[model samples]
Target: MTATTEINKIINEDNLVYKKTNLLLDNEMHYCPGCTHGVIHKVIAEVIDEMDIQNETIGVSPVGCSVLAYNYIDIDWQEAAHGRAPALATATSRLMPEKYVFTYQGDGDLASIGCAEIIHACNRGENIVVFFVNNAIYGMTGGQMAPTTLEGQVTATTPYGRNTALNGHTMKITEMIALLPGTRYVTRQSAETPAAVRKLKKAVRKAFENTTEKKGLSFIEIVGTCSSGWKLTPTQSNEWMKENMFPFYQLGTLKDE
Candidate 1:
């Protein structure tokens, strides 16, 4: 066999232990190196591909770091106003009852300006999946303090570190969502390690399955890293998230009913 043919044979599907999901487009992702958005996106795409729901899924992404999520994920996408993804997703779910709908949002977009929208959508039992990526600080617009920013964490707006007395306590929105009666499932997860990535993939699959079952709402809070925003290397960002974000956010399911 020719050398190129031999190499191609070795790289064929039967020998391929892993490959990128087709649900993820070839578009180069805009996320910074070490950012967790790309990882989370991959997990979601894999879940949809595994479930064979690519054509039946619609994703909504609002303003924030994930505003361009549609560019990477190969699915029907809707762009909502900043902090309004949940609202748009609610409408989409209602309009297309048979299709799966999901919202990809960031801390600043979901926990800040769009807080009310999410709360109401969950309360109303929207029958959609919500992927809430929390890196604590505002990543896209510049490293600013976000609603989920941890106490004592420094940011562009909080160079002295977040002070509860002045800045207010960080919001544990996932816990709050779990308490809402309209929500059928809510969990906090991360993707800093291989095991963690597996767990995250499972969570993503469950959330999409919930939607398929006509469950009210599935909220997956992915406590992620913002290396550039944190002014840390990817390794440092993962370490810092483990030392800081995990303790406060705490992984595991908050509710599954």
Candidate 2:
């Protein structure tokens, strides 16, 4: 056998401890180094593979950093206008009740512009999952302040640090959504470490599984990092998120039924 063939044979004979999930495509991730979007994507892909629901899953992509999520995730996807992912997901779940439909949106898309659509969808108890990635800035369209921007946080719009008096309080959208009667499951997680990523994967799995039971809306808010937007290295961004974001967001299940 040729050298390459021999190497492949030997590797195949060895035990595989870990490997990328097939649900994630081979396309290079467009997220900046240290950004948590890649990790979240991997966690979701793994969940989909583990549940054996790849063939029955449909994802709604929002018009933010994850606008091209379809490129990286190997599954059927639909693109929604800015912040309207939950609305599209609502329709997708209603029209194809058998399929697992989820919306992947960033803070800019969800909390800022798509606020009304998301609230109404959850209030109506649409049987779908909504994955909200809160990085506190508009990552795709320049690092502008977002509705979830932490108090005292600095961004392109709030260059001198967020002044609550001027910019208003940081929105606790997850907490607000949990109060809706239509919401069946609501959780906040992060992807800063292995333990955190594992927890996030479990949360994603739970949200996906809830759809099968015809549970009302399931919302998962992932408090993530944006290295480029934060003007910090990936490592620093994670540290900063832990120090600043976690305290306000508070990771845990807000509600589950």
Query: How high is the lDDT of residue 85 in model 1?
Result: 92
Candidate 1, residues 1-257, lDDT tens digits: the string is 11111122236655653333477677777888999998888899888888987778889999988988887777888899999999999899999999999999999999999999999999998999999999999999889999999999999999999999999999999999999999999999999999999999999999988988898899999999999999999999999999998888899999998
Clashing pairs in 1: none
- Among residues 3 or more apart in sequence or in different chains, the pairs in candidate 2 whose N, CA or C atoms overlap within 3 Å are none
Score candidate 2 by lDDT. 0.88
lDDT of 2 by residue, 1-257 (tens): 11111122224565633333477677777789998888888899888888888778889998989887887777788999998888888888889999999999999999999999999999999999999999999998889999999888889999999999999999999999999999999999998888998899989998988999998789999999999999999889989999999888999999998
**Model 2, clash count?**
0
Error of 2 at 18 (Å): 22
TM-score of 2: 0.91
Best by lDDT: 1
